[model samples]
Each structure stands twice: as C-alpha cells, then as structure tokens.
Target chain A: MSVSVQREDFDVGLEYARFVAGRTDVGGVALFVGQVRAESGQVAAMTLEHYPGMTERQIDAIAAEARARWALDACRVIHRYGRLVPGDRIVLVMTAASHRQAALESCHFLIDWLKTKAPFWKYEESETGARWVEAKETDDQAAQRWRR
Target chain B: MKILYFAWLKTKTGLGEEDVPQLPAGVTNVGQLIDWLAGRGGGFAEAFANRGLVRAAVNQDYAQPDTPIRAGDEIAFFPPVTGGVG
Candidate 1:
C-alpha cells in the first residue's frame, strides 16, 4: 500500500502502474477520486486544513485495515493538503485485487473509513463568513457498515 | 501543550493555534477542558459555550466529551468536520 499527502498534483496513470508494479493476476482495479464540489450547500469554495504528522498516519492505518480485511494486491491513497478551490481534486483511492468484488469492496471501505477516521477539517468561505461544518450523523452511520 | 482550532472556531477564538499550559487537575476529560476554557471569557466562552456545536480531538483522533486527555497531548477544538471522503 502507498499513501501520500502532498501539494503537487498526481497522475492517475503513473499511480496505477506503480500500484500493480509486478502483479500479473490483477483482474480488477477500483479507483475513486474526490473533487471539491462547487455546489455543496450553496458554498463558493472550501479550504481544507489538516494536522501534518497525524493526517498521514491516520490515512495509512485505514488503508492497512482495508488490505487486511480483503484480498487486495495493492492499495493506494492520496490526499492533497493546503488551500483548495472548488472543482480541484482533493483525494484519490485505488485498489487492485484478483476479483472485482474485493477491489470494489476495498475502495468503499477506504472512502468510508477516511471520512470518519482521518484528521481533516474543512471550512467553507461564503457570504456568511466561515463556518466549521458539522460532521453529519449519517457519516458515522455510513462507516459503521464496514465494522464486521 | 498546544491548542488548535479550525474553521469558525478558529475565527471565534481569534486564533488558529496557541501554546497553552499543561493540563490542569480535574481537566482530564473533554467536558472539564471546556469548563476550564470557558473561564477565559469572551470569545473562548462563545466558541465553546455551546456543547452540541463543539467537537474535540485529542492527539489528532476524534474524541468524545468524556474522552480522557493527558498532559502534552495536542488538544484541538473545532466545530466538527466538513471535509471530503476517500
């Protein structure tokens, strides 16, 4: 598994190759890219803030857990830090497995776990100034689905 | 110890981060920490005055109001989270 938190943009093609470096039995690869939505609750732009050391560790741990739970051949998670505008890419998750089910399941697990587990905070700057958005109870409940 | 704030909480605190004294006695939990911080008066009280609107994390992990905190732990107070998934 590979995890990175950087300001520079990432290439999905390059990242995908690195993920399946020497694997020939990889029959499926599931990918997820999260972009800063321009229309979330009528917000203009969103700024993402995170703790340096803590954020990376939390993401890596979640990825590891997903790998352990499924028969994944490779897993990759990347999240960008610093200020970001609407429509900008925020994060990406890719998982590879011999079967489609494992790959897809791992991808779902990665996203759900990151939502509730990672140490990231976002504040939307709008006409009403900035407000620290609340973590919805729905997110917690969504993550609970993988707690087998 | 360092106290960090995020989003609107940071604006209300008029600070994004601050160096604070070590944890005081009887302030080992999130509720106690808020009560102690409320004594700072003004903005501190306003930012954390509403228990339901506030959320906390100890050492970078989501912690409940009853979560025990230790000295030197990085305590962060914010108005919950609103970031992207995956």
Candidate 2:
C-alpha cells in the first residue's frame, strides 16, 4: 500500500512493477493515470490544490474500503499537489489482485471515488480570467453506479 | 487559527495563507468562520461574499459549511474540485 500526495511526477510502469514485486499470488493488475489537459476553447494552464491532512485520510479510507470490497494483493495511489501546467500527470492509481475481475473492479472503484470524494480543487487560468472548475455532476453519477 | 487557501480562492484572498485569531464563542463552525472572514473588508469580504459557492475542509478533510471547528485546527478554503491529473 503506497499513498503519496506530492508534486513530483511518477512512472506508472516502475510503480506497477514495484507493486507486483514478490507477489506470486497476484494474477492481475490495473492502472489509471490522470493528466492535466488544456481546457477546451481556453488558453489557460491548470493548477491543483488539496487539503493536506484530510486528503490523505480520505484517500486512505477509499483505498481501505476497496480492499474490504475485494480480495486485493496490493494497491497504490499517487496524487500530485501544488501548481501544475497542462500535460502534467496529476494522479495514478494501481491495484493488483488474484483475479482479473477484482483488479479491474477495484481500479474502477478507486478512480470513481477519488473523482467525487477527494478534497482537491482545480483552477484554470484563461484569457478572460481564472476560473475554478466545479466537480462534475457526471463524475458524481459515475461514482454512484459503484454503490448500486 | 490558521487558514489555508487553494486554487482560485488563493488568488482572490491575495494572501495564500494566514493565521487568524479564534472566532468568538458562538462562532464554532465553518459557516460562522466564513461570515467572520467575509466581514474583514476588501479581499476577504469579496472572496467569501458568495458563501454558497465556497468549499471548505477542516484539518484537511472535506467538510460542509456547518462543520464544527476547534482552535489550532487547519481550515482550508477553496472552491469545489475538478480532480487530480495523473
């Protein structure tokens, strides 16, 4: 279990390798990488902000819940903080399990929960002015599917 | 009390972070904190003018406006999140 909230970039391949290292029981692994995108029809860079202590706790809880929901071998969640520009990698989530279904489902569950539940905020610096991005309703609805 | 700012809220607040005096006895939660900050004039007032649009976290966890707070706790003020980029 690795959960880090940092500004440093991470290599998904290396992290995945480390996660599976010495884990003979693990039969499957899934990964998701989120990146800052240039806003559509806007000329602004992206910035991310998060609440320090609570962010770690909330994410850890999410991971723990996923572990309880599935039989997992290992899991890792890395999320970046501070100022970030377009194309920067912002978060990475990887999970491993004895079966493909568990690995895949857990991965989905992790990202879905993170999107709506994590306490991170985003701001886009645009030509008109800086805009704070709202948490998407679509993300909330997607997360709801997992609870059902 | 320490208050941290993030994203656009940081921009609007001018100061990214500040250490403020504890609110009076009855001002025990985020909503009261916002009302107090919004009364502080200029940028503080403008930043928190629209209380409904603001988001807050107490001691680093996402919290509602009515979340109770204690002294020495770190309260963060910002807008709703878009998400983390990988």
Name the weakest run of 10 consecutive residues (lDDT summed) in model 2 chain B.
Answer: B77-86
What is the TM-score of chain A, computed separately for every candidate?
Answer: 0.92, 0.94
lDDT of 2 by residue, A23-134 (tens): 8998999988988777675835766777777788989999999999999999999999877777778899999998999999999999989988788887678889986777
Clashing pairs in 2: A34-B85, A34-B86, A35-B86, A54-B60, A54-B61, A89-B86, A90-B85, A90-B86, A91-B85, A91-B86
lDDT of 1: 0.82
Model 1: per-residue lDDT, tens digit, A53-113? 7778788889989988999988899988767777788889999999999999999989988
Displacement of residue A58 (Cα, Å) in model 1 is 1.8
All candidates' lDDT scores? Answer: 0.82, 0.83
Candidate 1 wrongly placed segments (more than 4 Å): A40-43, A126-131
Query: Candidate 2 regions off by >4 Å?
Result: A39-44, A83-86, A126-130
Query: Could you give me the TM-score of model 1 versus the true structure?
Result: 0.88
In the range B6-83, model 1's lDDT, one tens digit per residue, is 767788889988877788777878889889988899998888878898878788877898998877888888765555
